[model samples]
Target chain A: MKKIIALLLAAAMMVVAAGCGGEQSASSGSGSGSGGKQITMGFSQIGAESEWRTANTESIKQAAKDAGINLQFSDAQQKQENQIKAIRSFIAQGVDIIAFVPIVETGWDTVLKEAKDAKIPVIVVDRDVKVSDDSLYVAKIGTDSVKEGNNVFKWIDEYMAKEKKTPRDGGSQYNVVVLEGTVGSSVAIRRQEGFKDAMAKSANAGKYNLLASQTGEFTRQKGQEVMESFLKSYGPKIDILFAHNDDMALGAIQAIEKAGLKPGKDITIISIDGVKGMFQAMIDGKANCTVECNPLQGPLLMETAKKILAGEKVEKLVYVDEGVFPADVAAKTLPERKY
Target chain B: MDMLKKFAGSSLFLPVVALLVLLVFNTIFVDGFLSIQLTEDGRLYGRLVDILNRSCSLIILALGMTFVIATSGIDISVGAVVAISAAVVCTMIGGRGDGVAQMPMALAVLAAIGVGVLCGMWNGLLVAKFKIQAVVATLILMTAGRGVAQLMTEGQIITVYYKPFEYIAGFLPGMPLPTNIFIALAMVLLVAVLMKKTSIGLFVQSVGINATAARYAGINVTLVIFLVYAFSGLCAGVSGLIESSLIRAADANNAGLNMEMDAILAVALGGTLLSGGKFYIGGSVIGAITIQTLTTTMYALGVSADQLPVVKAIAVVIICLIQSKKAQEMFDAWKARRMSKQNGKKTSVDGKVAEQA
Candidate 1:
């Protein structure tokens, strides 16, 4: 009878230990957890799609380290289903805050609502989600993707304006082509729309036409293939190649060399996502312009979290600042340009 | 006439018919998609060539898989074997140009084949020696193989330095054909010759038909299972080399992703029964060709990114349905009558069946 009682006590002790472990991890991000554990944070990345994505991932890791944040990382691998699954796992884990770079802008409302109901603050970074209710996300910390596109087209138009070059003097003087990103993606839709709007609004550069717009799916191989087709069809007529992202732009540079053409002079190029490669491209005079898409989320997110915690009003839409890099300026600033 | 009817009654007839339907549909809908074309190089250009070059890998895989499945076994590890062999070749060359290219292409290919064989042997040992389920054994290797490729290349595209290596992906001058297509075709022919033309092929079919019966008859079941997997591994190596050369680099991230799935799909589409007994090498090649041609056509038509995966899924499912036994039974009945009428018109002085044909 004594042995049975002892076994029961042991089993009860194990259950208590397991419960405490579950509770500790769950409440770690609360900032009120015992023994001063830095706020626990869960991050969901939208898969490694390219070199830029890989760099974005590394930057996040570094940010987590500098801020002393317990980062629970998950790679959705470009699958919306996986992203949803990871967020649910984060909620169940009871982390203090939840953050994710959305795979697409939709299908996040239900999960975001679940996180909100749990009293866990959800922060969106890099990309924004399209939810009917704005309260589902605490604050979206991302760059102005529309302006990023407008800036690329605007820079090209401005350069042509400064050169005093007009296509009316020659036939098909600067036939520009565009490589779109993923279909139905917030970045792809907004960038394409913004670029078109800006280009159309320009009375002087309206002569510069977009000959082709095809989806590269934001992959290097597809970018190379699409660029190859454009070159073959356009021949000497093609002038500028505007890609939605830097990785595709880099791939087009390789294709240009593969096809026996000069990159910067023969085919002027511009892209978004001021990644290390884009900077390198700018420094080497292979690419013309790039709009930065900052991956650093700590300062903005931490400040917002503090405000929310302090019961002070916070900004609903927090837009990260974007800057452009020209060939001359990029060479000087290459060393200091952090992603 | 009766003999012809019996032949048509075979399970492969429906798959062949479904392939025709897809061809017709693509011809109608897809722009610039007609397979019949002549290039400046005096060779065929279009869907046929696309299929020939790409289907070679899947054909070799399916031929080997047919043997394994006959023993009521499954392998989900062929993709891993391809990755390992490709990685091995890329590492051997180490992306050195103007120097490493001096080495004989045959030696490098043989070494790649050796690496694949080693991987296959490991899989065989795990399943046969340890008494593990075929799926479980292959699954273990499948998960590890990707990591092995990543470790080999240090997670970078390791480019190779070989001129002849590029030829395996396409063809040399005067051939006007992709080397991979021929390799695949030759392998399929070899498998068909072995199984239909040789006793060992018959033995494999018999063993798959009924393992207990084959064992009772004193056939070596274990040896047959081991050999099939090993051969499948060899096919995978050849495929990896050819495919890697096409890209000019070994990208471990997407090199062999979901390839084993495609091979299985092709094998099933080619009218090869998964329950294991009989094999269909020619039909399997056709199935692989059908898949490649479909992808090429979709790309040519400028199909959007989101729509590509859905299109592929629909095509595979529809082909599988057409290859089903019920569809085959229906096709055989239709084909037999058509054959008889054609024969009647050919032999008879009257030529009445010409109108019907």
Candidate 2:
């Protein structure tokens, strides 16, 4: 009986091994067939933690199909260790190119060095990586939070000017209150710095009084709670409300409406991340403007990957083009928003 | 004076005093903190109302947590269960451009609560039948429940545009208070009556104090443990409905995030021991209110968001110290020493007078 059991176990192991071997050979055979040798790219994603992230993943997948790149996608489920494991596996699989959205800023030097040694070009997408050697990755493709923040101020300035109520021209002082994102996050810090820089540089800098600023942790619930207290303390004195993200702004709009005040007219609301919900809010006249930090980087990433594989020199830092969407244009753009 | 001392010695004393102190501080420093204005929509709007309105969910969560803790078990999965419930409700009521429900609204809510009770039953099965540790059992659901919710929502934030659905968390026509306040009150009353009228409370206490002993005393220990967890899941399910309705969306990632910690803290602040035995329902309710008031107070005082947690930690420490029996004993000892010192002086003076006579 013992001998028979051992034989059965050995047979099971052989069958499993054969199945894995068949899968690998079939994948490699298809990779070489097409028009020419298809470029196999292994891309590891930081999990779908939010709607914005899911849209970003969709764009990348769609772009890969459009660009005719053989994409090997792995989800890290928002863990750095899992991301590292996926990168190591990609190296072992000997993919031509490797890419990942690093969940954190640090702790990628070792796996990246391994990829560099394996002679595979690595691309960092979305959130950046901090490695000892910059040459480990060929290029970084993502949005610039600082530029997005600067654009917010510029859009507000343009909107005020268009209304013929330029604060620079000695118009009424606007009491601006801010709902910041999670404290200590790089995006939050950079966006805040960009806003402050634009404010200092503008002629109407002194007219926009910052009444209060508090962290809303970039959630609808916290945003509403904080906005409720802000409404009670500052009352109708607040003329402008700026949230670090659209979710917080959406939450604040609810609080504003509950307080028997019109959001867009009573308090000019501006926020980042032009999500679909935010566009709907704009159409409803509850929000004023949104400076998009675009998540649709699929085409750019695939194009960059093709350029690098073709041995063309590419810029190390590539910024995706984003635009400002105000209420007037929100109606036209709402239907087309893929996110 | 003795009555005052007795009141101070009660478990409810510390949380009540903490809440009063926070309210008094806000009244003194925060402008118009005490004033409640009738909005044009006929709703009462103020910091006080906001505290009550916002804390309603937490209060409900704490009510369930009180019973779970009484059984010497913790439901860390309450937060995840909340996410799952929200996902179930929101997906059932599809986000149509027109304000229409895919299914009956009542059925959707009942299904959400039913899912929550199912989750709790799974936890109860693991702990009561399999003899697994409560934390480990609940942790399984805590980790997997969010993923389940994400799957239900298809990794999307399902925004419910049904106008009538708003009344779950928002105001009904011409109502002065948010519907959530009434929902919370009804839940509390239900739990209060269950504990007062039924022997389930006593059975839970016996099982918590000693399960083997309780079984020997002809108590159904397994059933008591199972029922507490089910009740806790019911509370989380109701909370999930309120939360999802508040934002009109099922955010699988953020809905009821870290709320389990807040619920556990509320139970602790109510002077309930983690080891399980005696319990106080009203104290937990007051503790929930105190926490919300503390948060509102920090916002009103203009504390930076990064610094808010630190302030809250300090306040919690102070309240816990005030509730500590050792601290009260030390205070009584100090008072006794002062009284004895005065008596000693008088005795010495009398001795001197007797010697002179």
Candidate 3:
């Protein structure tokens, strides 16, 4: 008990010291305001996991450098604890504005409260953190994962029609093998629910169906393995492959190739996250379609940061632009791609 | 009935029975489940090869665990050891480079093994020196070791770029077989030779059977305990190397996570006495395959995720009962009565003949 108390006292002291230091930094911040004045922008990333994350990190770094803003970067590494720690650190840093990609929907009450306590405006990007009150964040900028799923299905309907294959329910439904994202993740859960809802509500209900839905954890290997099993147990049964993310979709494609089968021609593959790999997959005619989930949050976040720091009213939610891209256009759009 | 009553040394029967039941159940209830494809591609897709690949790591974990269990010690930290080795290999080795540039892989492998040994030694010191329970000591290292692995890579996966390291989990030339499977098989034979063909194996078993008796017999009990944990670390280090190669990246959180459960379950199902004494290398190998097959089939048949634990629990429970005292007693008593009845008739006849004489 004494040891715990001592630890708590130490932690309290650290927090107070950090808070004081943050105040000092905020007073002498460096960022580009209206007249080229130095300002500060705090950014928190949802920890690194893959090449995509590295790209994200680089994008933000370059953005911060080019914008001449003092970027207070925090790598959460996909942990709520670490993310919370970073947020608290940002609060102590007292940057003019804050931006972060939330790892999960919940568990932001305490840290957001800290941000609120610090009187700093927060901008949400990539992923949204669930809060009881929307007043917590100044603006939220991200793609609609549900609409992404809808777009995939919409393309699938056209693809199936061109293939002249009757849906399993005799043109009423098409059986789908769904590779879901991590369980309890907002993207995975919502995207799955959204796709299910869209498929059910589509005009040709018999043209869309669900065979099996499993968590691939948004990895290529898991996606490949799951796809293989689906092929085994439900051979000739799965008509379409629906992945919650591009990574799993890519994995499924690998599994398909390993099986000595063509992916797009045999089984329709549709996914979100218009990553370069997905575009390459489209260009090679492996993946059928993709829904773009923009990763570049610099401009949108910067805009929100400026507004919040300037004491101007910003919209509570800012849905970023997102749309479906067919394989036909992949080659044409490859050069213009920035992600 | 009397013939059916024998089960003392038999360990494979229950696990096999449960496995068969699950297979049959799936064949019946799961839709299109009988679509059993015998093609090489089909089996490969079904995880036959992947399971074999995973078998090497599992066997290493089991081999290490065997000595630990034989000495009445347990190490829950092998899972975290996997993460540590993977991170070391990925970050230290500099990933996917030429032979000279791939020095980090070799260094990482050595570091991982060294680290694993150190972890085992730490556990050993706690159990042999400070008299801590093996379970508690290992559990502490389990959490802390994972924390260490996460700290090493800063929670980022460093993708391996070297082709040589890829061959660790990739394939053997021309055989279309994973290299890890062969490695695991070689380790199994090595473990078997170590335990059965050597005095050290007997010494460990004797110590486990009765530590006091072993001590009176002049056996160094503490040394044996320490040896067991260190051996466990070596096994975990090998497993970590294979696993890192498979993913081509050192993901601290996911690599070798929940592996301890699989290893423990494999050891238990192998009928190795968890309390200590007598290792079953063959049984452990079979147990690993059986569990892998069951997992593969379950996922293949579209088993609902919510009900996996329940099914696993029920299967485990049934297997335990089949090999339990209650079931054995019922069979034993029946056999005893039948044998006694036949013997009574024979003895009466013999007695009558003796009276006539």
Highest lDDT scorer: 2
On TM-score, the stronger of 1 and 3 is: 3
Model 2 root-mean-square deviation = 7.4
TM-score for chain A, prediction 3: 0.74
The residue ranges of model 2 lying beyond 4 angstroms of the native Cα positions read A1-42, A47-51, A61-97, A164-171, A306-313, B1-10, B334-357
> What TM-score, to 2 decimals, does candidate 2 have?
0.88
DockQ of each: 0.13, 0.56, 0.27
How well does candidate 1 score on lDDT at residue B313? 82
Q: Any runs in candidate 1 off by more than 4 Å, and if so which? A: A1-124, A127-138, A155-216, A221-292, A296-314, A322-339, B1-51, B54-56, B80-115, B147-198, B309-325, B328-357
**lDDT of each residue in A3-83, candidate 1, tens digit only:** 778866765654454343122122223233345546667778887655556666776666565555666777776788987
- Which of the numbered candidates is closest to the native, going by highest TM-score? 2
lDDT of 2 by residue, B7-62 (tens): 87787788788778877888999989899998887988888889998888889999
Name every residue pair that clashes in candidate 1. A29-A40, B52-B181, B70-B208
Kindly list the per-residue Cα lDDT of model 3 for residues B1-357, writing each as its tens digit. Answer: 554555423666666665567667666766655443344543333345545665678777887887788787788999999888888878777643233345655676788778778877888888887889988988998998888998888755555656667678766445466678888888888877876667898889998899999999999999899888887888888888888877666768777888888888778777788998987776677677766666666676676655765776776677566656678799888877866676677755656444533
Judge candidate 1 at residue A31 and give its lDDT. Answer: 33
**Chain B: TM-scores of all predictions:** 0.85, 0.92, 0.81
What's the ranking of the predictions by DockQ, best on top?
A: 2, 3, 1
